[model samples]
Target: MATKFALLLLALSPLVFANTASADTTNVLFLAGGRSHASGEHEFNAGCRLLAKALNEQSGLDIQATVINGWPEDQSVFKDVDAVVIYSDGTKVIQHGWERADQLAKSGVGLMFMHYAVHPSAEQGERYFRPWIGGAMETGWSVNPHWVADLKALPDHPISNGVTDLVRAYDEFYYNMRFQEDRDQVLDLVTAVPTRERLKRVINLWNQHGVNGIGKRQTLMWGIQREDGGRGVGFTGGHYHRNWAIDDYRKLVLNAIVWVAGADVPQDGVPSETVTEDALNENLDTYPKENPRIPLPNVEEFMQLPPATNVSMEDYENAKAAQKNRARKAKAKQLAK
Candidate 1:
């Protein structure tokens, strides 16, 4: 009787584990790089949290963020996980690291990627990353003179359905990846106008290195593919926390994850409205004072305009007048009382 009862318990264990693995929403595993500066910690983590929340609320998908400071040793971590979103660019010190993750990912799990996650490595370049991400950086991307984002043409792709034609974004945009074989591997491409310096560089490089169209560039904000008998997607512009709240951005990212997860299409379709990156920086108070080596934009630059140092009465008078008005209003109320 004791042996029979023990056998019955063992039989049920596998059933219980199988049931647990079959989740309502595809399980999303997130791996992020650590913050170099104090505020960056909050910024990077919050962005992942926002992505998970929106995927749950708007797309009805289950998402969990696990910040892998370095590569985790446990291989079974991906056993129940349906998809993995790698936010970490493999910059920090990790034990097993990108190579380990790469091997596991090839075993048929879905992948979603962004920003530094696609940044070039000695082990991999645009070619290697392209298969994993559906796109790779060729090098026109930059954070300087941070330009505005404008969504251009898309291929009538399901992933891009209802996505807006224009939404402003601020980031260090990627440049230089031309499709290796065919454009059929691409789903959508979002671009922004290049700075004059960028334009000239591309032209000169085209003539010099036999690299055609080096500068007449647009950043690839979105890239996707059906490769390795699996689905994969990537976004090149998720380097900031404030991007989470923008309506278009919120929908774009949520949709990307859902598509990667092989889930039902969203009912309301993609969101239409969006906020300017500058507005987000000003209102959210997310950026820092001293420029840290953080890769994304600084929110504080928008919050406080430069102090009136060595300025004339034109500037001082406006501030002074505003202060005087506040004082007058307070005085009037006091006297009335």
Candidate 2:
């Protein structure tokens, strides 16, 4: 696959000869909080810019990352973009911006949100943003000192292939989030166990701000999924200034871009079930663009989900009974053959 990709890039190189060349472009919009007014807060603007650059180079995707300094969220910001990553954690995304963000998330455009950006409404100086990326910020699990992140149950996931474990350089571990209702939607949960120093730090924060801030003290470093009828991912880590350039983090972010772009599917992926033409036509007036590919929130969790069956229960049962009779008849006829 790598060789084929290289050969394909070489094959396409001639297009670059023209200044007006239009490449096979995938546009990515990244929003990052420039800096925080809080004294201890880290400035993540430069880091976000670096992330966009790294993703662009590695994935061959065109990226536009801007530090949304007092920028109002507008629909046009995401218009025609293939995906959007919200990395701003300090400010609460205004109501209008959040509504629009939700619209985009549901419309099949890919979304990626990170760390403090998840906690938009925390009473602290940090503002919590809305839960558009399919997860919510609740509290911390453990305040482990920046420790190693262990990834389990994701051996074959594309984004997790080369990433077995990673240690955060220097950043507060964020844990305890109110995840969305569907657990099946979670692609992978990378846990950052608290170290002795992390526990001590959590204690200090609790003593200073009371017990509300720290609990079991775990934070989400990264995650993936395509759920609620849309494709998206949420990675809450990348707090330390230097972790952004680390090889694993770099690949993780790059893989995330490709996955969210709806270009990369998990191995041996199944196509969505087809809806009947007549029923679809009837509903087209209400949901004009709705297609079989779109998923819905009430769909069963992937693990617990039975195979997709759109036909009525009676019709399904009758079909199964007929199938059994047909099998029996075929077996009886096989003796004659």
Candidate 3:
């Protein structure tokens, strides 16, 4: 009788452990990098790290967000990931065919594209994109501009779940996107209108792109439930990394990630801890502030200043990197809380 009781306990242990492990774990992969921009802007890696921190710490939901600076050198990183958020140049990242989009789609893995990540070159659009994300931002047909957009109304969707008063910011918004033809397959998440005064000012600029014919109401964000039961989202914002500091903006993004991850999005959206500017600066690309394109300074002349003075790009980076390291330690403390 004692041996039989012991065997039953051992058999039940595995089931109990499996249930606990599978219940709330939603794994996310954030792929970022590509073009460089000025200080505090277009910091894809840094933005992604901060986003991961917000999701892990702030969101009441249980999620594990991994920030990969670029596509992983090790393809195994793709294994078991519930969803993916790409925040880089679409063509550059997707060009090599390193990732198998079909397997992910077939497995119902979710996807989210932030900013320029929505546009893959015409060549690769149909092959990998159409089936994965529903559509790609085709050039010539698409008009991208850096303008402030007022998101007065949002469609009812899981991404918009828990959002009551949406906050609008002066971001580098790219409007006039050319989405999939069968509009019913995609659900509009955010509908925004560019500032009329600014739009009037940039008429010639808009016309310069041959924007003679464009729609006034723009759909800047959408959610796609593919026929294969996979999920996807495309957001044409995040050009200005600073926008992540806004609560509504962060909430919307967090919810989308959770929803696409095959998890239950909180009714109030993904709850993130209040993010600080210091936290935002963490894990930024160590590119020189003066020359955003180059990774480091070209001359010793700029490197002569005191470390704190930040007279040169490297000096600034050192200071910032040091600050970020401290912030990371603090992140561990936040998790403890």
Please give the lDDT score for candidate 3: 0.69
lDDT tens digits, residue span 1-337, model 2: 9999999988877865532333345567777665553322333555555556555443334443333443454556666677776766634443337556657766767777666665544432122222345554544422222333332325576666456665333344455555555655555545544333233222211221223333333436445455445566666665544344345555566566566766563343212122232322221111233333312112113223232231233544566677789999999999889
Position 208, candidate 3: lDDT: 26
Write the residue-wise lDDT of candidate 3 on 114-184 in tens digits: 88788877766667676677766777666565555555435567777777875566555666656667867
Regions more than 4 Å wrong, model 1: 1-24, 37-42, 62-69, 89-95, 138-145, 153-155, 195-219, 270-337
Please identify model 2 stretches exceeding 4 Å from their true place. Answer: 1-24, 37-41, 61-74, 94-96, 122-131, 139-153, 164-168, 197-200, 203-219, 222-228, 265-337
Query: Top TM-score: which candidate number?
Result: 3
Model 3 CA deviation exceeding 4 Å by range = 3-15, 199-215, 289-337
Scored against the true structure, residue 153 in model 1 reaches a CA lDDT of: 32
Residue 285's lDDT within candidate 2 is: 12
Clashes of 2: 22
Which structure among the candidates has the greatest lDDT? 3
lDDT of 1 by residue, 246-275 (tens): 576566666666667666545554442333
| CA displacement after TM-score superposition, residue 330 of candidate 2 (Å) | 91
How high is each candidate's TM-score? 0.62, 0.57, 0.77
Candidate 2 lDDT score relative to the true structure: 0.48
Q: How far is each candidate from the true structure, as Cα RMSD in Å?
A: 13.0, 25.2, 14.2
Ranking by TM-score: 3, 1, 2
Q: What do the candidate models score in CA lDDT, each in turn?
A: 0.52, 0.48, 0.69
Stronger candidate by lDDT (2 vs 3)? 3
Report the candidate with higher TM-score, 1 versus 2: 1
